[model samples]
Target chain A: MAVKLFYEALHDGLEEEMQRNKDVLVIGEDVGHYGGSYKVTKGLHEQFGDLRVLDTPICENSFTGMAIGAAMVGLRPVIEGMNMGFLLLAFNQIANNAGMLRYTSGGQFKIPIVIRGPGGVGRQLGAEHSQRLEGYFNNVPGLKIVHTSTVYNAKGLLKSAIRDDNPVLFFEHVLLYNLKEEIPDEEYYVPLDKADVVRSGKDITILTYGRMRYHCLDAVKTLVANDIDPEVIDLISLKPLDMETIVASVKKTHRVIIVEEDMKSGGIGAEVAASIIEQCFDYLDAPVIRLAGKDVPVPYNGRMEETVIPYPKDIVRAVEDMLALRV
Target chain B: MVQEQLAPTKYDPIDRQEALMLYRDIVLGRTFEDMCAQMYYRGKMFGFVHLYNGQEAVSTGFIKQLRPDDYVTSTYRDHVHALSKGVPPRAVMAELFGKATGCSKGRGGSMHLFSAEHNLLGGFAFIGEGIPIALGAAFAAKYRGTDQVSVCFFGDGTTNNGQFFECLNMAVLWKLPILFVVENNLWSIGMQHHRASSVTDIYRKADAFDMPGYLVDGMDTLECRQAAIKAIKRARAGEGPTLLECSTYRFRGHSLADPDELRDPKEKEFWRKQDPIPKLTKFIQEQGLASAAELKLIEQEIRAEVEDAVQFGEDSPEPPVDELYRFQFAEDE
Candidate 1:
């Protein structure tokens, strides 16, 4: 076992993949020479050379399209966007091009590509830099969306994402990178599209991912102290959601609470909640509840932004409200 | 001083069979566009339909010269490109009909036609986006040591995009086996090329990228074929990429919805007078490639083919409502 931070795990995973496969290359702005924006790709360019670790011009759409093209031509490209917020500029290529190529080609082509970057609010990075776009991407089809909340899962899931014959949008929360966990030393992979039962219980189901996964875990502890056993499901992959696990858990508990760091309206939580009601309506004891960020621009202030986004206390309060409704 | 190795090929004597195939492709492309125009008017299709009514020679001439196993990538004005690559007209019509039998299972309409069998990468809707993709395909061809070349087709407007220059630089620098074909029609949407571009001559733009460039009369099918054959041969032989500027015109507006009044009435009449079909028909007749009766029979055959395609599209089933969420993953779990 190895104790490593989430960022370190990502670095190790990328290094291992690059060494393992000559076709695996990393390209992005400031990823080469200057290291990564967060120094995650530090010393990569020197080891791998400029051909593999590329420094692209500030054209996000071009680089994104180039990455797709590279992937189409039998290269596994790990494209890094400086921040997830910048992914908006490349949305056309990601949504229209990368997302459609595999199916449009009738499975003759596969884009084994990984587009990764930091997501969610961190300090006072303001509106553009700190926005959570998981929900925006969740609306797009033909993409596997993954959010790594733990160091172990980050390495395991990223390795799987690189090896998978699909385009994956790997969301690394800016706040969770420094957080540490013990990861196995041996090579392993955690399959995408399946949710992890982070903390299991029976009284209620708390579905969440990314930084909010930890927050939900904290909330579950509080709920336990108040004599409630809240089951926490970490949704690693958001698009091809393991509806089986969600519906099965919902059927057992009969109550659901979704926590997301993104806005309440049109959030991924809304989709999951809607899916639960549509697929397992008869099994529900109560309406599926969602504890998401308030529908507003993310604030720049540290404390105000923290309050606006979903917190452990928010999840606990929502669970308490749901329990009262059941009574 | 011109380098002998980089010079354009002299005109060659083409066989009668090759002549008929070229003529057939031009007619097929025109018929496909004509059907798309009528379908859009009848509300049988939705979204932007960029008809290639007056630009048949460019798609026909270029694609006919390439091997079926070679690849092609292009922009939104691509119903003709799809037809030229031998995508079933019925399948294209079904796509326009948004039916399950369509090329992309009705997920992608008019601008996004993709035929993997013929190595037609896709008709990417975004301008200049397909160039690098084509280059990458060509790169793969080179890497695998295949006798395949990838041709990228785009309109005059795409030259103004940043990716155009970037792709040109990379494709030329790396000696990627690709051909960049510019269907330089006078207008892009509503703006004239002269008004939109810093330098209106597209071939000169190719020169700046350190690659050989050629200017062809896009209205003349023979001229287009002559230029394209050389460029395609160059790319396939690993001689590096070439840029061909096919100066063409579009008889219709950019899309079915575009009420184009931007151009002079005289300019529109001038290009329409040089319609590719009539030009090719004259060549075929002047050279005695086919008799007048044979030409009439060909026209009848094409009309019948087009009508059958439209019927196939109309009779095809619409994509099931549940399939709206289909293809989200490779397999539905």
Candidate 2:
């Protein structure tokens, strides 16, 4: 085992995959010589050469669509958006072309492309740059969504996303790049559409993903001090959700609190809460609570931005509120 | 200089066999489209059927220059493009009928025809969406050190899309082997090109990307074929992409449901008089390539082929209900 940062794990995963398959390539703006905007793809261009690690012009729509085309013709392309906020520019290609191509083509084509980049609020980046648009993509069918919270899951899930024969939207938190954790030295792959139980408890289930997973873990420490045993479930796959695991967890705990970085309205928390009610309605001791970003654009002020998104304090308070509720 | 660049370049005269081949392909396309229109009225086909009526020459001319391994992507008016790229008439007809035997297995009806075997990538429903895809295919060919080129066919309105400029810039910058063919049929649905476009000349826009641009007479198959030869040769030789604007006209409305009342009668008559099939027929006769009886025989053969395709489509079964749940993702091994 070796300790590695989240971004290093991602780079190692991509490098290993590229070496294993000649058809696997990376394409995006500054993915080649500049080593990616965040340096997650650092040293890949030198190692793989320009053909395999391509540097494209700052045209998201065309480059994303180009990746789709390359995927159609048997190339497994990993397209890195400089930031997930910029993915809005290529939404048409992602939702319309890459998302619908397989079904539209009647199972004749398989789009094996992974679009990955740092997403969610970071260090006072304003409204346009701080948005976590996973909810928008989660609504799209024919797309598998993955958001990892640890170096292990990040590397394992990213490897699986590259190997899977589908278009995957892999969202990484901007803040988590520097977070270090020990990962296995041997090659490993976590299957898509499965959730991981990070902590085991009985009083309540804490459902979250991406950057929220870390905040929820931080809340777990306070919950333990207050005699509240909360089970933290890191929802790695957003689409084709591992509801089986969630429902089982909810049934065991008899209460749930969902956390997300996206806005509260129409967020993934709403979907998970609805699923819990539908699947295990009778098992609930209290109504499912959602702790998500406030329904407002992220402001440039650092303190105000922190208030808008969920923090460890917010998660702790939400859990307390959920535990106090009566059936 | 832009005007000079748009002028048609001269080439060697087409031989008798090649001319006949062009005539046969165009005739086959027309025959198939006519059957599609008839089938739509008879209620055999569903959805908006965009027939490639007068624009046969554009697809035939450009596709003739492409090798079987070369890629072709087209717009919703794609039946003729698929036919020209060697997709079986029966498969395309079956697709329009939403039959399991169709090219896309009845999932992508009239708007989405794909044949990986023929390298016909797809028929995109949205305007200007296929250009970048074609560019990517060209990139793949170059990355693999292959001689194959990719051709993207779109309407004149597609030039207004942001990706059109973006893709053109990248295609030129990367020197990818691609041919962007704009089938400028004078209208995008009900809107006329001149009114919607700021600059009326579509090929001239290619100059902004520093790419070679040519405007060809879309009504004449021989002229379109000659221009396509030069463009394809340039692409295959790794000289990068060419933007070819084939100024054609669609005799029918945009789709079968359209009444086509927006066009001026006089203007429509002017283009109808330049019908590409008859123009090619005249050239064939003047060149003494075939007798009138031989032409009649060819027409009869194409009609039979169209009838066979219709029957094949009619006989094919609809996809099973379980297929609805399939193809969301590739089946796991």
Candidate 3:
């Protein structure tokens, strides 16, 4: 195993996928000479040449639509959004074309394309740059939503996303790029539809993914000191959500707290909470609670950005409050 | 003399066999669309069914020249383009009928015809959205080091769409093998071209991308064919994309729902006189390319062929309800 940063893992995944399949390619703004805004595609241009590592103009809709077309013609194009937030401009292309093209084309085309980039609140990227787009793209059909938190899973999940025949929206948390972990030297793949049970406990299940998973784990430390053992489950796949793991956790713990950086209204947490209630209503000892991002736009101020999204303290309070009901 | 040389059949732009093939497709398009009008009126087809009536020349002129493998992306008014690109009329008709045997398996109705085998990308209902897709196909051709070209067809109104300009700029920048065939049918549904766009001259927009652009007589099949053939040659030779604005007109309303009173009767009469089908026939007779008897025989054959397509559509089964979720995700074959 070799130690690597989160962004390096993603880069390795892309490089390895491209190396394995000549048909796999990279396209986005500044991905060629500039090495990508986040450097996730660094050195790919030199290794794969300009055609394979394409640098497109700042036409998100056009490039995204074009990538969908290339995927239709049998090329596996992994389009990186310079910032995942900026790709909202191509939301129509993603929804109507990339997501629906396979179905709309009557199974004639398999849109084996990956749309991945950095997202979530980060150092106050303002409202536009800082966004949790998982909420926006979650409802789009024929798409798999992956949120990678660690270095190991980032590489494996990203490689899996690249190979997935369906269009995948891989959301990388901007804050977690520096986080490091040891990944196996040999090839590995994490299934797109599975959840990772980070920590096991008999108490409430703290369901979270992406950057929020770390926040929840941090809260788990305080919970552990307080003699409250909480199960932590990282929801890796946001769409085609890992319901089996969630159901098992819910059945075991009988209580749930969903933490996410996206908004409270119509958020992924809301969907997960509703689904848990639907599936395991009888098993639950207490009502499920959600700690999600505010409804308002992510503010530019660092302190204000922290207020909008969940903090470790929020998760701790949620765990304490839910456990207090049983007491 | 220059005008005479540019006219159809005057100098035999195509040989006898090619002429017959081109004429057959044009006839097929015209007949198929006429049947569509009948089907729509009879309540056999639903939704916005845009028929390509007067613009048969534009579809035939460009797509008839393409190899079966060459990609073609069309607008909502796309039945003819699909037919010209070699999508069987029966399948096109079946799609309109929303049948299982349709090109898109009845998942896509009239406006969204798709045939992967024919390389007909799809008929996008949204203006200019189809351009980028066609650009991708061209990009794939170039990336794969093939001489294959991608042809995108849309209307005059779609020129104002952001995707149109975005795709044009990128196509030139990437030096992709693509042909942007704008069928200037003089209107965008109810909006007249001059009123909708700042540049009334649509082909001039191509100059913004530094790509070669041609303005062709869309009603004249020979002129449209010549411009398209030259553009295809440039694309296949790796000379990059070219834009051709074919000034055609749609004889029918934008959709079946539109009342036929938006345009001036005088202007309608003028375009009616320039109807491409009759023009081709007259040219053929004048140049002795085919005699009247031969032309009549071809028309009769196309008429029967169109009737057969309608029968196929009528006889085809509706998509099974149990398999409603089948095509959502592709399974391992």
TM-score to true structure, per model:
0.85, 0.97, 0.98
Give the best candidate by DockQ.
3
Residue A143 CA displacement from its true place in model 1, Å? 2.2
Expressed as tens digits, the lDDT of each residue in A1-327 for candidate 3 is 889998899999999999999999999999999998888988989989999999999999999999999999999999999999889999888998888877877889888999999999899679998898998999998888999989999999999999999899999989898998888999999998899999999998999999999899899999999999999999999998889999999999999999999889998999999999888899999988999999999888887777998999999998899989996
What is the model-wide C-alpha lDDT for candidate 3? Answer: 0.90
Arrange candidates by TM-score, highest first: which order?
3, 2, 1
lDDT by residue for model 1 (B1-333), tens: 122232333556777788788888888888878888888889999989889899999988889888888888878888889888888888888888888788767877888888777777888888888887887677566655777888999999999998788778767766778888999997988888999998998888877877888888888888888888888888878889888888999999989889887878999998889998988889888888887788788778888898998999999988788656655554542
- Model 2 clash count equals 0
The sequence of per-residue lDDT tens digits that candidate 2 reaches over residues B155-215 is 9899899989999999998889999999999899999999999998998998898888888
B164, model 1: CA deviation in Å? 3.3
Error of 2 at A224 (Å): 0.8
Give candidate 3 regions above 4 Å deviation: B1-12
lDDT (Cα, tens digit) per residue for candidate 1, span A1-327? 989988889999999999999888897889999999977788999999876887876767767887787677687889899998998988888987788877665454678889999988888888898888988888777898998888888998999999988899999998888988888999988888789998888988999989999889888888999999888999888878999899889988989999988788998899999999999899888888888888878888888887878888888899999988876
Worst 10 residues of 1 chain B by lDDT: B1-10
Candidate 3 is scored at a TM of 0.98
Best by lDDT: 2
